[model samples]
Target: MKPQIACVLIFLSVGIALGECDELMKELGRSKTSLGGLANELVELRQIQRRVGRRIRSWEDKARQNEVYLGRLIEQRSISEGWLARFEEINRKLLAGEISSDDKEERIARNIVRIAEFQAKIDRRQATIDFRIGKIEKAQAQADLYRSRFEARESVVADIEEQRDAKKLLVLTLEADLEACKAGMA
Candidate 1:
């Protein structure tokens, strides 16, 4: 509202004195052209803002999926750890026993091998999960940055709208003054 008043005051300073109708029409033309351009720019900015909003939603969904996947990975790791512990306990019990059958010895050997292989698999999967988590963090940061840009652009669009309204009022005032000046000439 203040901006509208300021615009009117600025244009009023153009002096309502007669004989300047030609200059007034020229200024009015320039103001109209500027207003049109601003309107186009506002439309473009709003479209871009909507696109940004969609992108933000997409990233948020990705983040939620990543969290669920991460939780599953951690749970899987814990279950594997429990299995490894049981394998070690069995190996200890066999070692503490007296002489055993050949089949029992073979069973003990397989148990040790299984433990080592299972631990290696768990380690690999954990590493992969860690890498994925890093990627997720980076993507989230990018989303935050884009959200900030969208908000700033939104503010700019509002300011441009205000300026456009002010320009419109100025143009109307100029047209009225031009008509009055022409009437005075007759």
Candidate 2:
């Protein structure tokens, strides 16, 4: 009768130990699953960050190009203004009859055509400059938008990192508990 009682007690202890081990295994499994999900989230966030960075770079390049084109347009307008000024001076002289020449009428007609052409060029250049200015404004707006989105995502990434760290710590704790359980069973 004493032997039978000792055997039943041992059997109950083994059953309790097995139950604890099973519970620990389940907990460890849950921790591993949570860690994997966090890692996947981190990867997705990094991809989003890279894409936003690319958009910002593209906007910057477009803005730079617009600036270069605007500069050229300004230079062209300046040259055209100078030519128009010179032509106006010549026309004024011709009208004033400051010089007498056999081909005075022909020279006047030629000067008038040159002045018209210079004025047309100046007008065209001004239009182009206006258009480029609009484009530059649009590029700047796009860049600002990208920057805003990037900053928002960066904050999210930081949060995710913190979550990942916490999950890592949880996993370590779960693993330590599993090791202790195994040692107890041994």
Candidate 3:
């Protein structure tokens, strides 16, 4: 009877240990699945961050290119202004009869026309530069928004990484514990 009772006790102990082992295995599976999900999430977040960075760089590039173009347009307008001033000075001299020319009237008329037309062109270019400046400002604002989103995602990724690492440690511990438990059973 004593031997029979000892055998039943041993069987019960083995059954309980097997149950624990199964439970530990299930927990380990769950941990691995969760780790995989976290890794995938981290990857997706990184991709999103990378895209945002690209967009930011693109916006900055656009702003830089437009700034360079604007500078050129401004310089062109300055040159045109200088030319217009000289044309007006020459036309004034022609009108005042300070310069000797047989076709003085015709030359004055041509200078007037050229100054007026060039002024109009300069105004149009300035308007275009103004509009482009506004657009660059808007693009900068959008890039700032993307930067904020990237920072937010980076924070989330950090959290997920910490959780994943902890879960990985738990899985390792469980696996080691399961092996020890199995050896004991054997």
Candidate 4:
């Protein structure tokens, strides 16, 4: 009777061991699934980061080009001012009677029209410069926004990596436990 009781107890223990092993396997499967999902998310985040980096580089290049254009606009404006100054001096000399001739008067009128045309060009150029500056500022702002998003995604990826590592460790431990249970049963 004692031997029979011992055999029953052994069978009961084996059953419990098998059940525990089955549960561990299920848990390991779930962990592996979770780790796979995390890995996919990390890959997506890396892709986004690369795209954001490219956008930042493109914006920087546009800003540099705008700066060069602005410089050229400034030089043109300076030249226009110089021409206006010379025209003003000519008008002042005419008014002071230091030069008197119909040709001189005609020349003065032509200079006035030329100066007016130059002023209009300067105004238009200034407007264009302002528009370019606004666009550059907008591009810079977009670049900054993209950089922030990239950084945020990087942090999320790091967290996901940590979780994946922990899951991997848990799965390994569960596998070891399942192996031990099988050995015991054998």
The top-ranked prediction according to TM-score is 2
Lowest summed lDDT over 10 consecutive residues: which window, candidate 1? 10-19
Candidate 4 lDDT tens digits, 1-186: 999999999999999999999999999999999999999999999999999888767887888888899889888988887887888788889878887867887888887898898888888888988988898788778878988999999999999999999999999999999999999999
- The residue-by-residue lDDT of candidate 2 on 1-186, one tens digit each, is 999999999999999999999999999999999999999999999999999989766888889999999999999899999988987887788778886767878888998899899899999999999999999999988888888999999999999999999999999999999999999999
Estimate every model's Cα lDDT from 0 to 1.
0.86, 0.92, 0.92, 0.89
lDDT of 3 by residue, 139-178 (tens): 8788888889999999999999999999999999999999
lDDT of each residue in 1-186, candidate 1, tens digit only: 999999888777665543388778889999999999999999999999999989766887877788788888888888888989988888887887753545777878999998998899789879978976986897789888988999999999999999999999999999999999999998
| Decoy 2 TM-score against native | 0.52
Off by over 4 Å in 3: 1-57, 150-186
* Model 4 ranges with Cα > 4 A deviation: 1-57, 98-102, 154-186
TM-score winner, 1 or 4: 4
Q: Number of clashes in every candidate structure?
A: 0, 0, 0, 0
Flag regions of model 2 displaced more than 4 Å: 1-57, 154-186
Give each model a TM-score: 0.49, 0.52, 0.50, 0.50
Worst 10 residues of 3 by lDDT: 55-64
